[model samples]
Target: MRHRVSGSRLNMPHSQRVALMKNLARELFEHGTIVTTVTKAKELRPFVESIITRAKKATTITQELGTKSTGSPEAMELKSRNLALRREINRNFNDRKLVKKICDEVAVKYLTRNGGYTRIVKLGMRRGDASEMAVLQLVDSEEKKETK
Candidate 1:
């Protein structure tokens, strides 16, 4: 009856599905916006949000530990937390620059926001494939407004 099952298969095998999600997510982060199929956007929302959340947590931890004395136990703990989050994120995002952007800049931008990092806007259908299309973008922040 299709109950309790989660995540769209996206007509691809497990490996391919993971790869697609990774690429979609990376592109979305890099460009701040992307247009893809609606189904894919829905599937990607949670994936991207989780990474942003992780980055946010790491940023908080670093800030809290910054004032504390280095070489202390808390400092070591903060270092480990940052490293773990980076390792987890690096698996999907191969680019070092993008990873840095998320950890250093993006995380700081989202520090006050609890969640809901990405937005989805339906864009009708693709003419070639008739696929329902959507635009997925990072929610705008004050910093972004100034940069434009």
Candidate 2:
């Protein structure tokens, strides 16, 4: 039956689902938060988190190897790995600037921690069709306040 179906389809075809996730992700990265239906937010969480994880991994790879001008085997390998990860991340979003922002800013913000990069807060229901709503946001801002 519905056993291994995985991920909510959200009543959209494959292409629409991909596009919706991409747009939602772009908005989330640009604004640090977004509001959407709870079901959509649930689907968006893992998709967005995976991108963040890739960005973080790429950053870690560069940091680990530093900027050695020498063509050392280890440094070269790490550089290639980092590039591949960046390319993988780049293919998902339409905005190159947004991708850079994610890799440079958002990823670095979460480097000290592991996973759980996003938070979802329930906001009751929409008045129209009575669909449940929620605010999906990055958790780093709260952490920033605490560090100050």
Could you tell me which residue pairs clash in candidate 2?
none
lDDT of 2 by residue, 20-135 (tens): 99999989999999999999999999999999999999999978878665489888899999889888888998567877888889999889778899999999989999999999
Give all candidate RMSDs, comma-separated. 2.0, 1.7
Q: Which predicted model would earn the best lDDT? A: 2
For model 1, residues 82-134, the per-residue Cα lDDT tens digits are 88888788878877788888989888888888888889999998999899999
lDDT by candidate, in order shown: 0.89, 0.90
Query: How close is every model to the real structure, measured as TM-score?
Result: 0.92, 0.92
Candidate 2: worst 10 consecutive residues by lDDT? 62-71
lDDT: worst 10-residue window of model 1 = 87-96
Q: What residue pairs clash in candidate 1, if any at all? A: none
Error of 1 at 61 (Å): 1.4
- lDDT of candidate model 1 versus the reference: 0.89
Question: Model 1 has how many clashing residue pairs?
Answer: 0
Report how far off residue 90 is in candidate 1 (Å): 0.9
